[model samples]
Target chain A: MSEAALLHNSLMLGAILFAVGMVGMVVRRNMIVMFLCAEMMLQGVSVSLVAWGRFHNDFGGQMLVIFILTVAACEAGLGLALFVVLFHRSGNLDITYWQELREENQAAFMDREVPEEDREKTIWPQLTPSGVEPAANPEEELHRSRV
Target chain B: MLTANEHLIGSAVVAALGLWLMLPPSGERLRALGLVVAASGLGWLMSRMPGLGTWAADAAFWSLAAATSAAAVATVVSRNPVYSALWFALSLLGTAGVFALQGAQFLAVATIVVYAGAIVVTFLFVLMLAQPDGTAYYDRVGWGRVTSLLACACPAVIVGVLAMMLSSSLAGFEAGTATVAELAANVRHEEHVARLGGTLFTDHLVAVELAGTLLLVALVGAVAITAQDRQKTDARKTHGGGASR
Candidate 1:
């Protein structure tokens, strides 16, 4: 393919990838999924950078992508650490647990409108037991609820 | 040309709609319908692409893009965080394939090693800690009805505007951009890494050093942050919170 056509095609594909990531970031409540979306966005940017480098026949774009990869590694280390701490504090990984960090003017996200799924309690799967059930410990129940 | 542009724009919107439907809290039947909708939308978009001037290469490119995009979509919609991480890994591999096909051998391998090897593994570790069983109530119900609609709208509009702007700028793209003519020497496939390394050390040596330092700092920071909380959790556990599932 011609250099220009290759550049255009690569860039268009990158843009599409970036848009998918943006939608994921906006819609997903899971902290891990949100982080994955951020990485996806970075992936999109990497694709564009490589394409640009190839088009110019220069190493600058690829070099920058290398740096981005490094930064992403650092980000993953720190972000996962943060998630672990936060999960420990709240016993859940819901982003709403930290909604206090939202902008001052923004209305709160929690207790907004309960979705159909959220309204109904989670139904844990059960199987028939051949033996008598052990009495549930309060401490174990607390841990189970947290899980 | 006008009709082509409309198809391009319309396809994007359709795909976004299908993706929104696939988000958490949807029924299995709805998800199936969304799969069809999303597939058709992507098909329309691919039909408009200026293929790589050959059928074989075009097929390869589209296949990679499709795999990558489909995985990304699944990652976004999956309620199970473990599944999301897995799907993201698949997407990363697909992207690496794209990079390899585009003559970026080193970068493709680097992406696979760094992201799939390290990053996804780290995510899975943390995910297992917080959610051993894949599904959680919060994961099941993503957002309230009104907010979900707005969430979908915001990204759709952003993507729509971006597409329109990019398309509009196509005519002026080549003229508006400047190339570094001095660094235009062609490198062979075998020497691609050699040349890339030379350029990195010569032109961007300081940046390389800075990146190393930044990584070290992040390492220290993550360790310290997690360690500080460990003592507190341990103390709490000792106080009759010794519950293990």
Candidate 2:
């Protein structure tokens, strides 16, 4: 293959890797696997960026890749935190089982007898199992239930 | 029958070798054999092409590429995180070869420092701290295989189409034709590091400082988050406990 063609082929490979990473991110249930998939995706972008930098005879893409690295680090940190919290609360990392963090909060609110208006404002610990404080007042009880 | 794209061709061969080694057969000796064979083949190919180079330099580059690819593939396929980290370091070294071949010495070294030195070390630390237990080969393979296959397909298709088009439009084709010697000479034109450093410090100083500050903050955050010893105790309450207790 010609040099240009070869380099272009590598870039295409990088793009395909990026796409697979994206799809994995969307489809994977395991948080750790999701992060790995994210890294894979980021690798694609990084390779393409560097390839472009070399191809264009410019250093801008390399510089941008530095920022990308920074962002990836930040993402890993945040994702790990979320993973830790998820594991602590749910004891499983399954994305499907993570519905408690999603729409199931409404069901929890209904079980607690929280009124519609107070449900949005009040924040409750999703994993606070069987901890109850005596109702001080009806209004406070409603709010606490939502919490 | 010496082609101008000898190094490029060698690089592709090495890339293929690296990808091929990532498949199965996790034996170190087997892996080493595959790597050696690939390197030897690269050397033989270069030797067959007249006017290419002396045996020593050709062998050096070929072995370098082979080693790099081998290490990278090993990292991806390894079950042990520590082993994976080591392999990652090797892979970075191989990627540096590409930069070097392209005549980007500063970029090559920067890749080594940033990726191998910083990124891989941090990953190692996280892996150690987490200590992800048990056999995870099935999980990694099932996902990795599907993703890798899907990823390889598009590029193959695109390259095939482009090649057909280029073949048809031969006169209009603008494939790069710089040889290894030409690229090396171009890269060594002057003190590239000095120019890069000057541009980075002066024109991009603030942004650089910002990155530094952000990294510092992250370091502090990681330390703070990981330093906590107790699972349930609040920081204030824990401190209130008497030493005698």
Top model number, lDDT: 1
Which residue pairs collide in model 1, if any? none
TM-score, prediction 1: 0.85
Where does model 2 exceed 4 Å of error? A1-37, A40-44, A73-147, B1-83, B132-134, B137-188, B220-245
lDDT of each: 0.81, 0.52
Report the error of model 1 at residue B44, Å: 0.6
lDDT of 1 at A54: 78
Worst 10 residues of 1 chain B by lDDT: B180-189
Q: What lDDT tens digits, residue by residue, belong to model 2 across residues A43-69?
A: 667666766665555566666766766
lDDT measured at residue A21 in model 1 versus the true structure, 0 to 100: 87
lDDT of 2 by residue, B106-161 (tens): 76777777766766676666555454673233323333334444443443344334
Instruction: Kindly report, for each predicted structure in the order presented, the TM-score of its chain A compared with the true chain A.
Output: 0.73, 0.64
